[model samples]
Target: MRTRFAPSPTGPLHLGHAYSVLLAHDMAQAAGGTFLLRIEDIDQSRARPEWEALIYEDLRWLGLDWEAPVMRQSERLPAYRAALETLWSRGLLYPCSCTRRDIQDAVSAPQEGAEPSVGPDGLVYPGTCRPEAPPQGPMPDRAVLRLDMARALSVLDAPLRHEETGRGPGGETGQIAIPGDSLLRAAGDVVLARRDMGTSYHLSVVVDDAEQRVSHVVRGEDLFEATPIHVLLQRLLGFTSPIYHHHRLIRDAAGKRLAKRDDARAIRTYRDEGLTPADIRAKVGL
Candidate 1:
């Protein structure tokens, strides 16, 4: 029943973040399980030390407690590298040198006026770099490592299941079992590691959760589609699959989910404006 709240220290915490952290903490406390905090600061370009310090200050002000010293992703580069090498050795990875324009052109030009659909990863990659073998010899600059989707799917015929128990947005309690096909489609050849950072979100998150021995994963429902991919990665890397709970997101008055850019909703701003932790809990209807 152990659960974790993993927030990237790239921006100030917002109401959306508070909902996620409080949800995870409440779930763990209800089950008498451990609650852990993880700092997902892999995006070095955007992550800042001041933002990280704000995360600690805000979470503490919210009355949340983690089981151990925070786990930082930047300090775990060797783990990511080892996992990447394993995937490379298995021929499950290939280097992609295509830029965003190249992917868009490949998709739009082939199908006349076809509207592009967003996958779990935001952009549905046109598979422009789905090659037969790893690009021979050495890797090039500005390249990213993409998983071989078809090859990975061939090894995962059975339906993967990760259980979740929570009240839906409408106050209905239910459980969900993620299917394998959804995983394949939503996570189509996602980037495992970018040349700039040495690791991507999918790779770093799965590796960190496993290393932390997390028993339950609770996050916003927007990430429900990515669950299958995490399940698949756990299986491929021989890591244990933790239970998952995808809760509804906290939205603004316009019914739009909050983003890091919504400075007005930043938790630090709320705290500075004299909003208490109880005020935050009530705002999110927790």
Candidate 2:
């Protein structure tokens, strides 16, 4: 059993982060498994050296330790590009030139009481820039790459499903089978690589999890809707899907999800207020 706490070094570690990292550490310790830390600094535009240092300080202050030689995403562009090349060779990926405004305008409705459908990744892409057929030459540069979901599913033989060791926000559990059409509707032509960043979260995460040999994935429940996207990518890439454990989210008094911008609930702020590790565990009901 292997688990990881992959946090982006773009902001302070908050109560929600504390609950997640502590839970992952405790779970690994109980099972006598290895606990790993990976810094998700892929968005280098906002990632900072100071924030990365503070992540280490906060985790240590929370009475937790992880294996050395932590992985950082910024250093793995070649791996991501390699995966994209594989998908591109199979005609499962294509370059998309649609901007967010273009997608919204295409999918938006003019009639009253009708709003554009929203999917896991904001507005569902309307395939405005999707080519009628796969390109003949090499993959293009400086353009967003999107997966051809219909073509991808058509190439698969077996049914796509994953084990759920933890509950979802909607009580979805057990072996969840994902239908091809459902994925097409829910996450239509999801981006595999962005213009600025070579790889999107969906592509990078599944690759990293498989490379790390992670048997279980522990994360917030809000990401539950995106699990099928990862599962499909795993299938397309010939990787096994890990047991997903989506835990309850730590929210504020108004029942809103905690944001990284909310510094009042940051772990460093609590530490400055003289709170102990035990106090944090109790506060998060761990």
Candidate 3:
């Protein structure tokens, strides 16, 4: 029942973030399980020290308590490198040199009702790097590393399953079992590591969660689609799968999901405007 709230220090925490943190903390507390916090500051270009400091202050002001000495991903580059090396040795990874335009052109050119599979960031790569021979030598400049989706699927001996218990957007509590095919098709050949930062979200998150021995992952439902990719990576990397709970997202009056760019919804702005933690909780209907 252990759960964690891993936040990146790219921007100020927002109402959307508060919902996720409070949800994870509440679930852990109710089950008498440990609560942990991990700083997902892998995007060095965008991550800032001041933003990270604000994360701590905001979460503390919310009356949330996490295990001391928080885990920081910036300090764990070696671990991610080890994972990339393992995947490379197994031939599960290939270096990609295609830019965004190249991928879009491939996807748009006569695919016949091909419904694109969106990643967590909402981009569906069109497998431009799925070549017959794996590239040799050092990775290409500005090259990205993509997982061999077809090969990964072949190794999956059986369908994976995860149980989730929560109220749907309609407000009915129920359980659902996720199927393997649905996950595999939607998570087609996701990027494991990118040359820009040397690692992508999928690779770093799965590795960190396993290293921390997280028992449960509770977050916004938008990420539910990416769970299968994480699960597949876990199986490949020899890590145990943690239970998942994808809760509802906190949206604005226009029904759009709140983001860091929504300065009006930023947690710090709310705090400055004299909004209490209880006020945030009630606003999000948590």
RMSD of every candidate to native, in Å, equals: 2.6, 1.3, 2.6
> Rank by lDDT, descending?
2, 1, 3
lDDT of 1 at 181: 64
Q: Write the per-residue lDDT of candidate 3 for residues 173-244, one digit (tens) a residue.
A: 344444655655666678877776778889999999998899988888877767768888898898988877
lDDT, candidate 1, 1-286, per-residue tens: 7899999888898999999999899989999989999999889899999999999999999998898788999999989988887777677888888888887777677577666767777767767778876545543334599988778767765656666665434443344555556655556788988988898888999999999999989888887777777888888888988887778888889999999989999998888899899999999898
Tens digit per residue, CA lDDT, model 2, 131-242: 7888778988867999988889999999888898788878988998888888888888999999998998999998999988888899998998899999999988989898
Screening candidate 2 with a backbone cut-off below 3 angstroms (N, C-alpha, C), the clashing residue pairs are none
Off by over 4 Å in 3: 112-123, 133-143, 167-184
Q: How many residue pairs clash in each candidate?
A: 0, 0, 0
Model 1, runs deviating above 4 Å: 112-115, 134-142, 167-184
Model 3 quality (TM-score): 0.90
Question: How many backbone overlaps does candidate 3 show?
Answer: 0
Residue 280 error, candidate 1, Å? 1.4
Per-prediction TM-score: 0.90, 0.97, 0.90
